[model samples]
Target: MNSSSSQIDVTLTVKDSLLGDGNTGGGRYNYTFDPDLIHVTEHDTEIVYRLAKEDQPRFRIVNLYSTDTRDQLDELEIREDGAELKIVHRNTYQQLTVVSLLVHDTKHDHPVNCDPQVTNDPPPVGP
Candidate 1:
């Protein structure tokens, strides 16, 4: 499979209001791409969410689901570190689809930068 052909683009944005109150805040993130352009089952991809250094311990994931079906994708496994959130998918029969993620935090009074990166791993070598 061609790795470049299965690349997916993700967009993440935080509202200014989230930076005004330290109480509770949330943001919506979306992932989208042309279904015809990528063959999901043939590629393995990971979505990495990295938080700004200072915001590492402040923010947390509230809920994440598919916008189209409003249901979580069972194929995804989430891993979190002090500053990074990683979502991994090895092989899925489902098509590469759109998804929405919600992140909530208590230390939102300060600007919290979140960067998302998508990496498609090459399939395992065969005999």
Candidate 2:
């Protein structure tokens, strides 16, 4: 068997907006893909956020999706402008807000539904 090269992983995380799961307010969904060889089917309220392994924006909400709450990444898009290096995301189910910013993953940001609050203090180290 042989492996493949030149692939990019698109991690899609979806969550339900209503019917709070009692203890939790929402549910999560996830999908992974390499857009170079596949078609991405986006819902009417979903959007895409592309980041480096270190959480830097490589591409933002360029090809914005329109579903209630979904995310997808697809194809190699050639840039005619110098804007792909910025951060982009949908603050809502509609419209986009691109920023030169970085966001820590919130419960709302995870398909696993974990909106946790953390202190800046790093974990205790051995003395």
Candidate 3:
């Protein structure tokens, strides 16, 4: 498990125009992941999720949950004062896993929901 195999950075931005005036709802925000879909390979020992510098002070990842718990992830940790998540995946058989991130907005004192996808499918053996 090479922890340094890959690193993913996530960013959060708000669409003020979509929210209209004086609205602080979760719908206004957009969460963008660098690779969007994380593909865990055999060499991957750890997967890290971090907030972009611009969004670090504004939001924090409070909790994370996977839709399928069995054979998807071995261990999960929320670190860096809830600004990052470290995940260890042992089973590389699962095709798709949806990880839901519970985020808290420090600026607005509200909660936001974000879903990220993870897959352990091996690369095509041959054409």
Candidate 4:
């Protein structure tokens, strides 16, 4: 039987950051998906990642982090307008799981040209 029940928030967003990881002493490092980058304080360090079509439900990674840390590590706030990632500590990844932050890539800002038709090998010659 389909019964209607009260809807509760199963997952939390970046806006609810203050309430995140109180005991962990830190919060999830928030990331946004939009026109990026805005320098914060001089000491603050910023890292950027481009989430391709494959990287979806981006929040899942953060949730996995929370569970793995046993809630000791808190989540940081990530907003579209936010260009900086703030942390109470040096902001090292401890058991954090995410790939391709694009730190070393110098040409990251430019859109990637994905040509399906381009083949590395030439066509075979007919007999």
TM-scores for every predicted model: 0.41, 0.19, 0.75, 0.18
Q: Which parts of model 1 are misplaced by more than 4 Å?
A: 1-15, 18-42, 67-75, 81-83, 90-96, 108-127
Global lDDT of each model? 0.39, 0.25, 0.65, 0.23
Kindly list the per-residue Cα lDDT of model 4 for residues 1-127, writing each as its tens digit: 1112211111122211354542221442233333232212111122222233323233222111112232222334443322222221112332332221211112222211111110011112124
The Cα error of candidate 4 at residue 107, in Å, is 32
Winner of 1 and 3 under TM-score: 3
Which prediction has the highest lDDT against the true structure? 3
Strongest candidate by TM-score:
3
Screening candidate 1 with a backbone cut-off below 3 angstroms (N, C-alpha, C), the clashing residue pairs are none
Q: Which ranges of candidate 4 are over 4 A from the true structure?
A: 1-42, 57-59, 63-75, 79-127
In model 2, state the lDDT of residue 123. Answer: 21
Q: Write the per-residue lDDT of candidate 1 for residues 43-112, one digit (tens) a residue.
A: 4454444444444466554444553332223444344643444454454333344544445555543333
Candidate no. 2 TM-score: 0.19
What TM-score would you give candidate 4 relative to the actual structure?
0.18
Against the true structure, candidate 1 reaches a TM-score of: 0.41
